[model samples]
Target: MMETGQVRDFAVGIEDSAIEDLRRRLAHARLPEKETVEDWDQGIPLAYVEELTAYWRDEYDMRRVGTVLSQWPNHLIAIDGLDIHFLHIRSPEADATPLVMTHGWPGSVLEFADVIGPLTDPVAHGGKAEDAFHLVLPSLPGYGFSGKPEAPGWSVLKIAMAWRALMAALGYERFCAQGGDWGSAVTIAIGALAGENIDGDPCRGIHSNMVWVTPPDEVMANPTEEEQAGLDRIAWYRTKDHGYSTQQSTRPQTLGYALADSPVGQMAWIVEKFHGWSDCGGHPENVYSRDRLLDNVMLYWLTNSAASSARLYWESFNSGEMPQIHMPMGGSIFPKDILTPSRRWAEKTFRNIVYWNRLEQGGHFAAMERAELFVEELRAWQRAATG
Candidate 1:
C-alpha cells in the first residue's frame, strides 16, 4: 500500500492500441438470437444491441470521452491499501465549502461531470458565490481507475472511512456529502459514523437522491396507499428486476468472466439497466446520447471491473443493518427511480430531515437524465444543510 497522504496527478490515457482493440472486440461480437418477445419484457432487444454495437464500432468517438476526462483536474491517492481515484476541483471563493459527491454501480464520476463546473463556480452558473463548493468526485474502489480492493471488507462503512481519509488528505477538515444509489448509502454511513461514536465528524450534513429507509414492521403493518405502492415497487423489483442483483451479490466472479471477455455482452448487461431504470420513455436514447452512454460503459470495460465492482454487493447487500444517522439530511425522490420510499418511511431512519422534494421528472440516473435539476437539487440541499 502506498502512503496514505500521497496524492498525485492523474488522467484518462487509454492508448490507441486499447481503443483499437475495443473496436475489434465489438466488430467480432457474437450475440444471441433475437428474443422471442418483441418488447423489452425479456431483456434488451437484439435489434437495439446490434444497432448500439454497430454505432460503438463505426461512429462513436472514444477520443472525445478521454478529452472530457482529461480536461478535468484529477488525482490518485492511497487509502486503506487501495489507490482511490478522484477529481478535486476547487472553488474560486476563499471560503467555499468542500463537498464530496460519490457515484454508484453502473455509474461513474461521469454522472457528475456537468455539475462540477456549476457547483465549483456558482457565479458563472448564475448562483451566488456563497453557494460555491470545492467539489470532490471519487471513483468507488475497484471502479474506473481506482485500484480494486485486494481483500474483502470494503463495504459502505469502509468506503465512508476512505472518503474521510481522502478529504483529510486533501486538506478538508469539514465538508458535506452527496450521492445517489450506492453513493447514497456511503454518504449516510459518513453521517452515521460521525461525532463521538467514531472519529470526529468531518461531515457537516448529507444529501441523497436514493436514501435507505427500511421501516420497521409496525410502520409497514398498515401501509398507506403510497406506502403500499412503494412496497409494491420493492416487491416487483425483487421478483423481476433482482436477477442481476442476486447474481452479483452471490456469484459476481462467475458472471465477470463473460462480462470481462465480451464487450458486447458487457454493453448489453449495463445498457439494459439504463433502459429499465431511466425515465427515457421507451428507449435509452430518449435520455442519453450514444456517446454519453458509451462513455460510462468504457469506464467499466477499460477497468475490467465487472467482478470487483459487483463484489460490493457481495459485501453489503444482506448485511441487514442500517446505520443510524442524526445529522441534517435531505433527499430528492425521483418518481421513476428504481425505489422512491415515502417521506414517512425515510424519516424513520434519517432522523433530521431538513429538506425533501418529489421532483416532477428524472429517474434512477438523475444526474445524467436531469443535470440541471440535479444541480438545483444539490444547491437546495446545501442551503438547508448550511443554514
Candidate 2:
C-alpha cells in the first residue's frame, strides 16, 4: 500500500531576474563555426541556431508560459519522500473514467495541455459525454516542476509505485494509464502491478505511443518487412543518433554543467531533437510554432532540471529489468517515431493488446503534435478498456 502526504497548490512564476539572466546568456552565447555538411548530419546549423537564439532573447515572452500553465489546476503532493507535481482535471460526466497521463523527458505537463479540454470535456470537443475522462497529468520525477529525487533508485518501477499512490490518494479506485517515451516505461511498470488496487487492479488498461517490446526468438529470426524496418531504425538510432542518450545514461552530470549554464546550449540540445525526431518535413517549424516549442524548452530552463531529468536515464536505462505487463495494453504507432515495432512483435510482450493502430501522421510527441488524434486514440482505448 502507498500513502500520500500533504498536497499544496503549485503555480508557475519564474523570477524576473532569472528571465533576464537567460536573455543575457543567450545574447552573449559563443558559437562554433558552421557544420561541414549543409544538412543536419552534423547537428543543427549555426546560422539557424543564431536566428533562434535571437528570437528567444529579443521576442519570446516568459510570462506567456506562466499564463498557459496557470490554465490548469496544478498541485504538488508529497509521495515517497518527494513532491510530485501534477495537473488534475475532473470531467463533468459523473462516471468518467480516471486517466493518468505521464510525460517523457524534455517534455512537461505542457505536452498534454491541448488534449485536457477535449478529454475532460468531450461534448464540447465533438464527442459524447461517455467519452469524458478525469485526466491526471504528472510531471515525471526530476522533470518539470516535480521535486527531483535526491538519491538514486527512482527508476520506472518506483515511479509506477508513486503513481499508484497518487491515484489512490486522489480516490481513483480504477483508472487507465497513457504515455510515450519514458512515460511508456512508467505506464508499463504500472500495468505490471495492475493487480494490486482497491478494485484489485491499479490500471484498467494502458496506452502508449512509443512501444518497447522484445520480440520472440522466432519472430526476430524471420521478421516481416515492417518489423525489419523497425529493427533497422532502432539500429540506425543506436549508431547515428544515440550520442545524447549515451551521455545522459552514463554521464549526465558532466553534460548537465553545459546545459545548466547556457540557455542557448539547452535550447539547441532540445530543439535539435524536435527537428530530428518529429515528423516535420525537414524542419520543426512545420509542426510547432516558435512560441509553443520555446514554452516546452523553458520548462527545462526555468527549473534547471537538465541534470535531474537526465538522471532518470542513468537510473533505469542500464537496469536491465524488463517488467512483465498482464493488464490490457493499447498502442498507436506513428510512422516517424524513433521506434515503431510491428503488432506481431509487440504482441509477444503485451499479451492482451486490445487496441493497436498505425497512424498516418504525427511523431514522437503525438499528444503535442496531433492533439486531436491523440485524444481520439485515448478515447478509443478507453472504450475498449470498458468492454
Candidate 3:
C-alpha cells in the first residue's frame, strides 16, 4: 500500500485533451426543451446552465486550484489495494484532537478547504485558541481523489473502518469524527462501533450536521390533530422532493450516462443541487462565487468521475445500506433539506442521541453550501461530546 504522502497527486489528472473534449461536448450539447417549472422541482434552468458552461469553458482554472491546494500537506494510503487520498493538516498546536472529516456525494475534500485554514489555525484566523485541531479530511472510496473500489462491501460502514485505520496510521490514538450526508452515516457507524468491548476497536465519538429526522413515533404512532396536519405537509414533500433520492438509489447509471457525456449536462445536474440545497434559496451564484462553484464542477470534469460518483448511489441501495444507520450519534437537521426526521424518530436509529440541532438554514450539501456554519456546528458538537 502506498502512503498518502507519496501518492498525494491527483492520479487521474486531466490532460489538455479532456478540456478540449469538455468544450466540444458543451458546444454541441443537445439540450431538451422543458416546461418553465418556475421552481427547482424539476431541474436546473437552461439559461443558468449555459452561463455556468460559459464560465467553465472560458474561465475556470483547475491548475490554479491545484497550486492553492498544494500549500496544504496531503497524504494517501493504499487501503485493501485501493489508494485512499486525504489531506492531513496538522495543527501547530501540539495537543489538538485528531479530527477526521469526510465529504459526501457530488463533493470532495475541496469542500472543506475554506474552513480548514480557520479550524486548524484558529488563532491566526481570528478564532479562539481552543479551536485547534489535527484535521484529516479524506475522500471517500470512489469519490474524487480516492480510488474506486472494484469490489462490493465498500459501504458507508466499511469507509468508517478505513478512516479508523487512517487515524491510526497518523499515530493518533484517540480522535473524533464529523460528517454530513453520506458523511453523517459513516460517522454514525464509527460512533456506534467504537470500543466494541472486544479487542481491536478503533473508532471514537462522532458529530454530524446532516440528519433528515423524520416524525416522532408518538405522532407517527398516534397522530394528534396538529400532528396529522404536519403529516399532510410532509406527505406532500415526499411526493415532490423524494424523486431525486428514488432515481439516485434505483438507477444512478441511467442518470449518470447523460451527465458523464456532457460537461453542460454534469454542470446542470450539480448546479441544480447547489441552487436548491444551498441557503441562497434558488440562486447558486448568491452563496458561492462563480469561480468556486465552477471549481467544484471542474474537479468532476477534470477527473471524469460523474458516473463513478452516481454508482455510489446505486450501490448504497443495492447493498441495503440505509437500514444500517443504527448507532450512537449527534445530528444537525436543516429546514432547507428535503425532509427533517424528528428527534424522536432519529433516536430510533441513533439510540445514544446526545446532541440534535434543528438548524434554520442549510440543506443536503450542507458542508459546501454553508461551510462556515457547518464547521462551527461540527466543532460545537465535538467539544460537547468529548469534553
Pick by lDDT: which candidate is best? 2
State the lDDT at 354 in candidate 1.
Answer: 90
Model 3 Cα lDDT, one tens digit per residue, 149-187:
777667776777778777877788888888877877677
| Per-residue lDDT over 1-387 for candidate 2, one digit per residue giving the tens place of the 0 to 100 score | 656897789888889898888878887899988899988888988988998888888898877778898998999998977999999999999999999999897777888878999999999999999999999999999998899999998999899999989998999988999999899999888887764341467578999999977667866799888888888878878888899999999999999999999888899899898888889999999999999989999999999999999999999986775655668889999877888888888876787889999889988899999999998998998898777
TM-score of each: 0.96, 0.97, 0.86
Worst 10 residues of 3 by lDDT: 1-10
Question: Cα lDDT of all candidates, in order?
Answer: 0.87, 0.88, 0.70
Q: Candidate 1 or 2, higher lDDT?
A: 2
* Model 3 clashing residue pairs (backbone): 4-75, 4-76, 212-341, 213-340, 213-341, 213-342, 214-341, 214-342
Clashes of each: 0, 0, 8
Model 2 misplacement above 4 A? 195-199
Best by TM-score: 2
